[model samples]
Target: MKVAPAPSKAEVISLGCRLNISESEQIRALLADENNVVVINSCAVTSEAVRQTRQAIRRARRNRPDARLIVTGCAADIEREQLSAMQEVDGLIANTQKLDSRAWNVPASSRPVLAQHTRAFVTVQNGCDHACTFCIIPKGRGSSRSLTISEVLSDVEHHLSQGAAEVVLTGVDVTSWGHDLPGQPSLGQLVHAILERFPELSRLRMSSLDGVEIDTDLFDLFAGEERVMPHLHLSLQSGDDLILKRMKRRHSRKDAVDLVRRLRKYRPDLAIGADIIAGFPTETEDMHAQNKSIITELGIVHGHIFPYSPRPDTPAARMPQVDRAIIKQRAAELRAETQKCRDRWLINLIGTEQQVLAEKDGTGYAPSFARIQLPEGTPAGRILNVKPKKLEKGLLK
Candidate 1:
């Protein structure tokens, strides 16, 4: 006799970076067969992020009244008691526990459904070793840990076999991968291994990487590798040296500039992106000017501009704070500058051939990570080579 398939029983609402999104997939796999479970994979990068998380929790509770709402991620880990007190949150899982089979109460499984995603994000590393004075993530994510090279290759192979055209290596601090493992293999070695093992893998990408920790091998890969995507989003918190020092960031303004210049020398078309915080404590006008100037100087085509919002217990929170109004204004100005850079890049791409990974509804992303509107009815997950004839509504046509 034939049997009916099981119904959908779980849902995950991810509210953070690519790393969180990648982990949410694992959480979804763990709860795939369970009933009435809703997981809130939260973010706590800033106080605003924590507030948004709370809002998400309330919304999730309203929508899924019958489901058991589980909260997990940086916010949940750091603010356990506070989140636990929320009536909507039924359980709390730490960032470390999210990957543990025991936490899910299920047999260890590798069968993850990519579900509506053409690209698969394989988390090879987690947590951070360095403590940036402005960051609370290390507290939530714990010390650096890495999956062995073989384990990472296995996951990559699994995703490739499941028809993933692109595989992105994601983590809390991806560049710190392999430090906790045998021989302390570098991230570049891991990338080399993945490429060597799976020659047919279409595209390989990395999430945000710290500029200071990038190694020689990784630099060579960026210079010459065609398979590794040309878009790099850097974890550059500030472009001012004084701000960098205050934030306890390893890379200085000169370091960031030199890195970008070197990469662009090899791959001129490389799309550079960075996370810059505006109005950090004690930031003078001259410092803010330097921050604004770096975008143009480095040709940053993509930017994640964040208004400085202090988190409780972080060292920066105790520093003399910037006025809220000035912070917002500086953030706005930085965003405008970023937009100009992006528009300039987009203008340059006009009439150039773009390798677009078609996502949903005739929309996709180009190699430079720019949005492209493909011919209507173009199916998702198909990589198409087409010349972008013009720009339409901020998207390449």
Candidate 2:
């Protein structure tokens, strides 16, 4: 008996970060030619990712009324019950294994799957053991688990065969990767393994990392390898020790500072960035000032600030809530302080050489934590050596 072919499709999409974007690209490539099947990759990190996801879905539904929709990713993972109940979505996938079109509840089309972009995200690990008070990822994703080395290597080989320009290793706790392996594989070992097995991989980027994961041996790997990008994103929620304790963060202010110092020592040209929560519950004015001062003293290249949003089922949520007025005020102040530091950094870069990966839309270069806006007609999606000619306040030069 001959099997019949599936129909064609369109897709809606959203991405959380570099890693999310990478994985989502792969998902879209798989669903690209379903003729009438559509996929919408959703994100729910900040308020912005959610807004973007909704907007993308709305546009997809409007443009292709007959297309079957598959919504998946962090946003959907956290709210699976809610997402599955949505009238628009025919299917949803969390931080799960790559499911075929058969499970998608949509008939498969005979159209060929394609490569989405120049780079791809190969997630070797998919869960988190750490439970930061403010985070809800563990709720969405289960306990720490890793994909077999063979599984990951197979994906890497396939990526190289498909001509991937780069691969970003992604996970909730990428540093804790290989912990569940038989020999308890370390991050350095996995990195070395990938490099040795796939010499064609030009560049490999790490997703977000934590201070607890920093070690001298890992830095040796970075120092020994040029394929690793000279960039790092460390999660540092607060600079005040008391606030950190309250937030139940495993790392202290000193730990974060030391991590930055060590990374920069190894790679002088490294662009360092941090995440911050401006107003945790019961955080006082002095504590906020301490947090601001620490960031300024560390000389981080930039900061991504978030006003404290209490999530349900977290210890921090039950703590005495600070007045909304106070939270808002502190958030604004932290933002302003961080803005000054960022602007000063940009100002100094007016005459420096940088490797910039520009976008195809001829938009601008998102160099680490900052965005560099050039003349609109400039070429997109090319890594070019750029010299900052001038500075326009805090954003770009």
Candidate 3:
């Protein structure tokens, strides 16, 4: 793997989301020639995220007192007034404009340098059109939009040229890509196009997808495509039917189960990951139980359990709220269940060979996104097949 020379002048502190990390790298390139500038690509997915953004702003200001500091990303747009009012914040760029070269008042670098990252993330879509009651992303991101297939191919080509062994298609609503385009191509078509165009590209992965929107074409690729990874992270917020309805989610509990079941038939080793909210408004004990049970039912080894936090102006915020203590307890229980499932799954993989992509962190990831401990001398960005004889500290080695 060829790593780009580190930038000397500009520094970026990416706060959240893989999309922000991808965008921050582009920002880094745009500012590569500039002097004494720092950018904070912030997130406002939760109140906690927004608070972290503020903390980052102050810390960046202290570290670079003479340098110009700029804030951009979802938090900067959604919490514009409050964040801009901070004395430490020099300026705020609109989230939508953050990617444009003009936003930084600089010509786009002739060659955008990818920061020290092993897997290149290529954002195919941005924004969300869905009105999930618990989400404030659409307000921050505006409308659902997609890059044209040609544009996507170009992005993939650039990453490949940068020596990216794996390319991940990422976005706010990745599965919603191409809906606003001319022919309304499905997400599967985008993946097919990339694989067809770049045969040398070994690994092609996708970010979280809306389970209900996994079209037949995408399902087929997941089931049989050798280059496409056998891992799927669904944007499933709850397991109880009522909570899903209240959240304005498109899929029912059964929809998610059936989708996973069908995909696993062709690829029995497929890994399941999900975003499960523990305590939504109006959630009862039974509702939380359903949420806990679904983890084992779906065999969700990589679970992201978010304790429901009310965001300003969201519908869920206005509804009857769950007690914070109970929410915390529920979140803990959900996490424990996920760990049990993961521990068992890892145990089952003992002595099984996995093709792992090494990262700079002295770790690697399998096609199913399972973490593997690499030998001490392994170089970054090399793909190797290794058999794990033990599981230690939640990593297969």
Query: Model-by-model lDDT, in order?
Result: 0.89, 0.71, 0.92
Flag the better candidate by TM-score, 2 or 3.
3
- Residue 272's C-alpha lDDT in candidate 1? 92
Residue 327, candidate 1: C-alpha displacement in angstroms = 0.6
lDDT of 3 by residue, 219-337 (tens): 99999998999999999999999999999999999999999999999999999999999889999999999999999999999899998999989999999999999999999999999
lDDT assessment of candidate 2: 0.71
Query: How many residue pairs clash in each candidate at the backbone level?
Result: 0, 13, 0
**Candidate 1: deviation at residue 6, Å?**
9.9
Runs of candidate 3 exceeding 4 Å displacement: 1-8, 109-111
Model 2 ranges off by over 4 Å: 1-8, 45-65, 84-102, 105-116, 363-382, 393-397
Specify the highest-lDDT model's number: 3
TM-score of each: 0.96, 0.83, 0.96
Candidate 3's TM-score reads 0.96
* Candidates sorted on lDDT, descending: 3, 1, 2
Q: How accurate locally is residue 366 in candidate 1, as Cα lDDT from 0 to 100?
A: 82
Off by over 4 Å in 1: 1-8, 110-116
